[model samples]
Target chain A: MTEAHSQRPGVEIEFRSVTKTYPGQDTPAIDNLSLTVPAGDICCLVGPSGGGKTTAMKLVNRLIDFNEGEILIGGSGVRDVDITALRRDIGYVIQQVGLFPHMTIEANIGVVPRLLGWSADRIKARAVELLDLVRLDQNFAKRYPSQLSGGQQQRVGLARALAVDPPVMLMDEPFGALDPITRNEIQDEFLKLQNEIAKTVIFVTHDIDEAIKMGDRIAVLRQGGVLAQYGTADELLGSPADEYVADFVGADRGLKRLSLRLMRDLVKVSGENHAAPADAPTVKGSATLRTGLSVLFASGSRVLKVTHDDDSATVIGTVTLDQLQDAVYETAPKAPTDVVVAGEA
Target chain B: MSFPTQVIPNFSGPNCAGQFFCWDWVGANWFSVLQPALIQHIWISALAVLFGLVISIAAALYAVRNSWFEKGFSALATFLYTVPALAFFLLMVPITGLNVGTVLIGLTGYTLLLLFANTVTGLRAAPPETIAAADGMGLTRNQVLFKVQLPLALPSIMAGIRIAVVTVISLETVAAQVVQAGLGTPLFNAQRNVFTTGLITTGLLAIALALVADALVVQLQKLVTPWVQARR
Candidate 1:
């Protein structure tokens, strides 16, 4: 399996027993942190302020040194590499957008490339391509940072990060400073960009909602830089590691789970219901229960006919609330294995 | 009624237009007497201002982020300022007697007093956010100091330069007393001759030079500080 995985190229970022402590501090900022983020997925670090989420993100690029441990990018130690070269090889976006007020957007995006000594023509072309990638016009390239709105400045920041076309990206609350509407727009746009690029990303945020929306895996951090929990979003949501994790996830764990829980895992029916309608209410395989609920409500049908998009929206089975609770508790006897198809209604 | 005729002395003398103070003396020697020294004074003052500005900016950049360096430079410059100009020139007279060197050193030392304070003040005037933003962008220390801090600190730095320029020009006249040249020498020469007209003309010319240099610095400041320009 390892060889098969190694046959293909991928970025794997790992922190091994990393411990960081500031002088005169009672505790380490990051205490014995060890986590793995596989390539082509967004691994979010979410927790309250001073949770070491930002510190963990910074360590990925060696912005802050890890005192007791090593961090590996694609399985090589970061300390072994030159910091400037290493940083140039990884994309970084911070909350404040940090656009150089003195330089044009094109120049800002072209910074790392210029440092790497790319040709002026190539750098300009890459700058234009990155601007378009981040959903900005090439016409805006000549404008200074002061001419841009905060959201626009952030797009430029993202473009600048992506300038060198690195395989790994570190984001420290990239959308945290924007308004809610703009934040969502940028987040959605970033996700789209990430999907196409497939870069291994470590994103830090104080928002659990954003974590659930963006993370393939979520690492919940606690005060004093402790890892409260690290698992799939569903795993953490369905079964919190501890009270600290639970509280950090907040009182709306069920609602969070609605987004995390697959429709297949959450759907259930009574054992006695052998006969089913051919045209019962069903949701698309990709639809969340939040969407499923809305469909079920709009259809005015208690029994939801779960349909799969690729499976031609065929009615597979019906799901009711009792089954949902049983599925949540995992108390129901296992259903027939062939009864529901994966990614099928 | 016998009113006593009281003799009141005429304290306000008759207006003698050209008897003692000849207005024509100013027009005749305005270019000859005042022009060369005034031009030289302007050049000397400008050069000293330029030199002082460069040193101050360099020192300020080094000092702003490092507390020890800032304190050291400030303390040393302050000590230099405390030495009286006359005593400083007299001390320099033995080494480099009665020439431009004596004047230049005295004026340079005076300039540092204003320049050092201004440089430090200008650097501190930059917002902390600006520094953080530069760091967040992965700008090197030198890049942040030059590209962000220096530009942001320009107004304060210029203000200091202007103050230093004015102070140096004024001090240059005092240095002139020791050097035996410049506007001060001419005023002393006129005082020796007891010619009130020459004194008035030379004094007016010095004041005019000071005003012109001051106005020019202000214009240069406006040209450099476009951000502050927008604020106004």
Candidate 2:
């Protein structure tokens, strides 16, 4: 059974003209949606409540079935696969974390594996490996979910989803219930974790900033479940499809775009004449341009030294506000009239 | 009064008789009749509750899947509960005869309302998010019912069972009228013969039995649901 779904690099998810309408509702919840999440990419579906963002995600796992059209996982129609087997192969994490209260962390994480009838020793080994993957202490495996903090519970939720090492994962506002500080902290850790695993992920959220921060590609849905735009984060922010997309992305589109670029990407090679000033604030090369900009403002300095730590902290270059601004514009050129025409048409 | 030697009917020291209290009568009859009655009472009540739980859980699982069934079954259970216990036993006697069967049928009917209603309520009370999570993770309908929903509903279900057990214990005493067993037999016999000692002792024992059953069920609930204790 395990060999049947032996880990592929990542599976692509395709939604072809799919629609969902709840009983007795005149309008469909998901209206003729067509989108694709490429292999090994995180595609975020974001919109206001009642926009069918969640409905679209549920259709992937068939938690709820679609009314029309096909939802394909790796080119095979979802209807063709045994649903339980399909679900076991696709990881799912939710905002509430739904860790079984009666079960210990180890048992909760090993649910899918146990359901697949893996050996006891194999399940225990998998649980230990997952706890470490989620950056949790191994001792946590023996504790119940009630003993953990909210953020910790969410990590356990992720570990449980990843138990079978499924090539695809569906996350519905996974960090939506946490405090802002914890949410930010988890988001950073989550991005770092994603880099190592690289599962094909379909992330659903109402928060656009979170989408911008996490999505490799984004599908913006409107209230009637219509797809407003499907593009890269920079494309959506650089040139929104229409007024709704523009307003939805918010007024600070430029600053949001700055978050997409790293400080290392913008750093200028320091000439011999330009030595780092003693008062200049130093930023790690891996920091975001947004962080670099914030540091520049707080320190009230036009220039800041950027460093990369190999064995020791070595100053690599200096970055200026003008340089940061140039980097943002360079990536997101002013939208041509033709670009808006292409979006609207 | 200057009465004959036998006139007072042995009203002397601890052997008092015909003195509205009779220790001598109680001592002689306690093991011979009352001990078996107590044991029969416990056995009948335990069986009734066990049967009621099995039937109720099955009905609750069915009811949860269909709203129409839930409404209809709840109405039927309420109707059964409203019938007087004596009337139900008498009604069952025509089909089941004046045996333990008649007594158990009546007692089990009384337990059904609490067990069925609470089982349904407990299952429906499971968090929607938890149910969705279970489904999304590939739990089949049956697996979800047994593994996820049932375990979470245990506390509410246990409370219902505790009430049902205690209620059945008391109701079983009344079964002695038709079945010829249980504590009610001694009380009924004492009433006919005007034996005050037998009546009070049997009544007190029944009450004590019910209290012990309720306490034991409470302990079982606490033991099974460690998570609820941790929350507090």
Candidate 3:
């Protein structure tokens, strides 16, 4: 399975008993953190401040080297790789959008490739390709970062990171600086991009909602850089590892679990019962059961007419609150079969 | 060459129509007296600023991103500025006695604080995240400093150079007391002879030199930082 995954564009990232301690500080920033993110998944490292989530992500790119243990990307240890060559292959995006004020957007997007000595014509072509990939206008390539809106600058940031088409990405609160509306828009756009590119990613954030929305495997870090829980969003909301994990996930874990299941996924698992045509409060098939429940609760209706994502008015099926409740437990029962390498230490 | 007195022998006060700023006297003495002084002024200011800039760049690079070094170096540069210009020249006179060296040394000392502080500030003008991104994106240490930080720092560095150039031009006038160089020579000679037109003419020439240097630096700044102008 590991060999098969290595051949893919995205490769597995494993943190094996990784511990980091800063000089002049006795306490470890990240104490024996161990988890594995399968190919093409986002492993969100989330906790309160001082949790070492950022430190753990940095260890992957060797930005901040670890005092003990090892980090392996695609089965090879990170320490053996040449540092500059290693970094050039890792896409990095930060909250500042990483767009330096001096460079034009085209130059910014072409940075990594330029560092790799791509031909001038190739870099220019790559810049246009990336601007379009991140949904920016081609004319924006000539503008400086200061002329761009906060959201536009981050799009440029994303484009720059993807310039070399690296297999791994490290994003530290990349959208944390944007307003809520823009954050949601960029998050959705990024998810759509990730679907096509499939880069293994280590995303650091303090926000749990962002973690649950973004992570395929969520690693809930506790104080002192301890891993309290490592599992899918559904597993995290369904059965937290401890009281701290439960509290970290919040009181509305059940509703949060529902948010992870779309009506289309529900129809696939639960059969044609969801295919019945009925005059009910309509919800899109692509939306979460959470949205269906919102409609179910709003109009005092028990069932919702689920429409195709493209044709929203057509009713494919009607689902009740009870049906969604069953889905909360039924979805993705693959279970947490991961190594859980450090035992939450 | 005809002496100023011979050239303007019929003048009432070695002046132009009794005006303090006598244009006739200026025209008569320009090549023989004022023009040489103006050339000397440009040379002194240029050398002082050039030396100051090289030292400031070295100092700024040393002081960058370290608060302790920044504070200590800024304090030293500021102290250099606080030394009265006369005292500064007097101190230099003991080591490199009354000549262009004393004037150059004194004027260069006067520019250190402005140039050093602004260069240090310019080198840090690239935000922490931008620098971090540069590093994270596989830029070597030197590449980050040269390609990223230096380019971002151009406006601040140019501003420092502009002020330093103008300050050195102004200081070169006072330098005449210790060194027989720059516009200060003619102005001092005019003072000794009580020639009103010569005094005012020399003074205005120094001011014009400072203005032209400042404008030239500004244009140079605009040329180097086209990305900065895109914001406007």
Candidate 4:
């Protein structure tokens, strides 16, 4: 992870005392909101509707201009560049996916690149590359958006956003509409994709669980667009600043936190190489601690075998319930506090 | 009297000289008169639709951006549409001097209400999410309007054009009242002379021309919006 972080390139987005008010509204939708997402970090802005979370994301790309203060991308004001050029350089995904129904998947993915004036050949090449990056088949590119399933359309939407290889991404509930199984599938794929791309992402979602799962840093916003708390997901769930955030994180935060740790991180290597127990339940090293715990309980076992395939499926280690609990507590603080702040300044 | 008789040859009932229809008269006039009228009818209708489309699209785009403009333009187009076609043609004759100009101006006005209303509806019908996505991706105002909004609105716009073309084709026949061109001139002459074959041939040909124009527009719409047809 550290090695990947060292190589990742991304832009920093800073919102300094930003405020946006709709016409004829008495109160500002976003009132003096301030936050910062460091380069190569996924900062999830989680809040209820009308909490200004979506509005805050929009302000980043200047989709909706702010009434006061400024938004800076990579230390430069968003307004400094031409609007189209600025947009071309920032990837954007929405809940609806908004894939142009008229265009084929290839054309949809190539939109930003074409807007940037790339040649036809270059755009086609980039479209194929993006389809692969988003884990979609190249053949799918020629299909129209209407022909794609909901999950496929979302993937294409993500591919289109990444077409220009923009360093920053503004995602407004990109997976909010999918069914739970597909949503989880795409979210996992998105996380894997982020590892390769390392974009500075400002993701907005009303789902706190999703935010906790995907965000490197989570910003909890209240009704008036107030930044109630901003910190690592562990910190936000472990210690919410107020009742509003506490309720938002919900009662099952402990289980949610288990999702943050991997079984590999909690596995205890056995000193003696023993023959594999045929009856012992096996969990992949890549499985979440939560899944390992579930398998342990379901199989009525004190310990579960951790298997990872290098050449063949071999028992690499064992993870006991005790070790899983200890590992969870031990690694709780280890969640990167790269920029953990409590309340707004 | 002989000139009228030569053009019509027979004014009587269904079967004249034991023939069901005046095939001879139609064949004779096909090159000399009816053929020219068919060409002129097509020319006038095509010009009216072309000019009307340009004007309406421009107005609709503008109206989509401004609510006041939408309301004002719509009301004006409706007013122009409500004006009797014959009266409007007659009104333009004084200024246009019984030329193609008088007929085209009136026909264009008749098309404006349908085209303008549909264009506005189409432009406004672009999904909000789609518009936001386009804008968020850094498309300029013009690019969004043209590349995103316009293309998405094309299905509705094409429907409007189809209706407008058929309407203009039928209306161009009215142009024959003032100018001696189009299928209407022969049909009117047949009515005056009570020539059964000339009336049937001209009336049937006018319907056929409108249907042909309509079919061509439908094909053009399908060609441009393959995505729409492909969905089905």
Candidate 5:
């Protein structure tokens, strides 16, 4: 492991005018894709199937090499570093949850560290710590991957990626293999985990909703490997760059943005009443503003009561449809957030 | 033809017990004749199989890398498998002379198909995703093959070895006609005089050797691949 890679903090990943054209094909797989994922931030890349979101993420680790321009991690070009060392330092997770079936969970998670030649005791300790971090039971360390469910396997895959405590993580639909219920549960758990670890991430997914949920910043790529817009979810929702982006974010962009903000935050921010009248329909404090609006409409009431996240008995506040609507309007794009780094013709 | 008729004793000759599988002759020849033939049978089979295994491993690895080579070697392995042991021995006589090497060559060639297929299939048995993940985690191509793919493939490869061993043991009897080695030599001698005792005893010994050899390889397979047993 290099000195630069051993540090705990996440490092910046920059893709500058990168283009990847496969042999025997005229059209490039990734056409001059450029995005800067800042340290300690999650930048999700979402688009249609052929938009090259995965190809873009793979380029950072040099899993897929680019023919034009350069990809730099924390200031040094990826080509300059040893390929094995570069990948070992960058966490990678895929939709398949590719845990070695032959290896026990502990060994699977300790793969990169073992590759780095860490002592046995250190690798074992790291496995324990990561299992706890990923919320797996301690006893699971001894079990093989075949014993685990899809969600559990994906968790192991994530733990394995984080084994080296890599600064940057490239995840391609990491939760896509799970059932919807498990996907939602793991997605919530992963978001919570991300808040604590805060590694710079380049997340690739075809689902726009997932991008909106997991990304601090979302890059919306269109067909033909072109970036339509790159900005915060609110920026994309509030002020889309073009008709293509506006359509890509969908007709329900307003509702999608509401899902990003919780009812508790709105209640805490708007200085709304706490513990409103019992007659109003009760909505959980943890419910997003979008759900609050749904409850308001479903109840046919003027306002809806929001209960505390932990103690449902304690009412947090009341929210009106008008208030939720006003919150949506307040997010209207003020200035251009599209920062495409494309330097190609 | 189904029954071995050569084991009948030459009752007309002196000390010939007029019965099938005469124990008296067996007791007298156990150390002097039968024992030597039995030991030589096992030795030839072991060396043949060992040579076959080494070649199969190298060929299988190469075959997996090139599709055209895989296709070509597959046809070659099939053709080698169909060459009857008697014909195989006959073909080797002109090139290898009446030496033990001729017998060894034929016996070893017979094992190549079984071992090669097993090794190649075993190596490819590793999940593609697992291999890709290993590469993503910084393992080189060789490391992935040796560490992940090879271990995952052990069960199939060992299974192939077990089958090849039993097969080579059976084929060594055919080698007796070529180089007068192994149990085949005594069986042929019994046939010349229609001695049921020698024929039955030698044939039974060859079968016993095959059974014991098969069991040994099975145990070895289980030892090397305890994970497969665990899975079951």
Candidate 6:
């Protein structure tokens, strides 16, 4: 309970120097890693396979035990709580979906509720409501996992995890198995669902672009449970911590940063009513940095003013090649706003 | 019951007990001699098969849970089955001293070998995913035994029953040698009397009983496993 007050408003999870080592293993899967996830925020744990991202996420739910230190849910130590009771209060979604093949979608989603001893009628209603929330028709509740498409089955998996109305959600590559189009759709649907539910979520993924799009805070992990970097998407992209972080972001860091720097991040420098200069380039405010770069190239300017497409055009902001380069190549800044202003051309 | 005094020469042709007999005897005593033969044969075979199945299932389940016991049980069943039918009955005579109980014990022992092997194989064949799914559902061990593994292994277990039923029919004849009466005793006596037509009639009756019983088993299988049929 004392930890709850320390967690900023809406924060529900805290992991304190947790470590786990299996017998006969030379190195621990997670080695003294600590992180606090505030409530109502998407904190993505991103790293390549074998990194401790999944281990860190699982510790919050106590799916795996920690050898040292502790994990807390809503300020209570996970170790002190009963496992089944704890799991019922925290939602978990895996990449495989792990849907019960023999049960209908409704029964699958209602599993936690049934375990919690809810009345039969209430469980059924909740199952239907969850199905609808996931964008599936109520009629499909009776269908088995095989009857639903992979995306639909994954949606049902999410619904099942959310059935008990847990305050914390841990998702491990939830969309990793789907085709691109379906993955994007599920991600968008999840975001909408999260906005309404506002659960403190720890989402794990290896995809940097996905982390940028879906995470409010991204924790990049290295092998051996090392913390490569932990910051907002803009901070991570505009300023990686070291060569390891930069390399993990890959060689196309410039392009990756373009997607991370939203128009709002560069909005303060807009020169209102300023007539367009002959050498200046123009880009739509909504355009990504990659697209903005094309406009800058055609006009041969270092800076581009981003404007609304409406007839009564609104000046949103200005961006430059230096800011783009800073976001693409700079190290983790002590303060993100400082880099935003200093990096401006 | 001794078959109603066979009206010899009235049923079979002029020579009375010749090799090629007439159908007259079958029509005359169909309700008496034939009915008891059908009832007694069916009773012994059904009871033996059921007893064998119950024993096999318990043994198989125990084996599944303990690898150490499996080898010993497998050896025991094999040893019991190797004793020839007549020898098995003759061995039982001293213990039970000649009665239906002795006949049942001998047939039950003979059927165990077939049932035990099939049952072990069937339970082992249960899909790993099915077991994992049940575990994930939090079903208790007994629920898993009766609900998941038992139903999944039903077909293989049923095949074992079929094999046991056929074996019981043949073994029950040997069992009759230890008892005062059975379908086998009448045939055995007729062969000694050199009444060849009587031999032919009992042989035909046993074969007919086997055919009918096997057909009923097939029917029961279809009824029990409609899901398999639907899948096919």
Best lDDT goes to which candidate? 2
- For model 4 chain B, the run of ten residues with the poorest summed lDDT: B1-10
Off by over 4 Å in 4: A1-8, A21-27, A267-284, A299-332, A335-345, B1-20
TM-score of chain A of 5: 0.87
Model 3 segments more than 4 A misplaced: A1-8, A24-27, A272-279, A309-315, A329-345, B1-21, B65-80, B87-99
Off by over 4 Å in 6: A1-11, A57-63, A263-287, A291-345, B1-65, B74-90, B96-232
User: Cα miss at A260, model 1 (Å)?
Assistant: 4.3
Stretches off by above 4 angstroms in model 5 are: A1-7, A272-278, A307-317, A331-345, B1-16, B67-79, B91-97
What interface RMSD do all candidates show, one decimal each?
Answer: 3.8, 1.7, 1.3, 1.5, 2.0, 5.2
TM-scores for every predicted model: 0.79, 0.88, 0.88, 0.88, 0.89, 0.73
lDDT of 3 by residue, B113-148 (tens): 999888877887788889899888889988898888
Model 4: how far is B196 from its true place, Å? 0.3
> Native-vs-model 6 lDDT?
0.73
Pairs of colliding residues, candidate 6: A10-A39, A11-A39, A238-A327
* Candidate 3 chain A weakest lDDT stretch, 10 residues: A336-345
Tens digit per residue, CA lDDT, model 5, B170-207: 88887777688999998888888798988999999999
Least lDDT summed over 10 consecutive residues: which range in candidate 2 chain B? B2-11
Residue lDDT tens for model 4, A1-345: 323222436888899999898999988989998888988889999988888998899887777889999999989999899877888888899999888888888998888878777999988877877787778898897788878889999999998888877889999999999999999999988887787778899999988888877888999988888888998877766667878877899877667667766665555332433444678899887677789999999999878888884522677777777766764454335534221221100
Q: Alpha-carbon error at A328 in model 1, in Å?
A: 5.7
Q: What's the i-RMS for candidate 2 in angstroms?
A: 1.7
Residue-level lDDT of model 5, residues A95-166, one tens digit each, is 998888878899999888887899999999888888888889999998878888889999999999988888
Worst 10 residues of 2 chain A by lDDT: A336-345
Question: Relative to the unseen true structure, what is the C-alpha lDDT of residue B41 in candidate 1, on a scale of 0 to 100?
Answer: 80
Q: What is the DockQ of each candidate?
A: 0.12, 0.49, 0.61, 0.65, 0.49, 0.12
Provide the TM-score of chain A alone for each candidate, in the order shown: 0.84, 0.85, 0.89, 0.83, 0.87, 0.85
Of the true interface contacts, each candidate retains a share of: 0.07, 0.56, 0.68, 0.69, 0.49, 0.00
Better of 2 and 5 by lDDT: 2
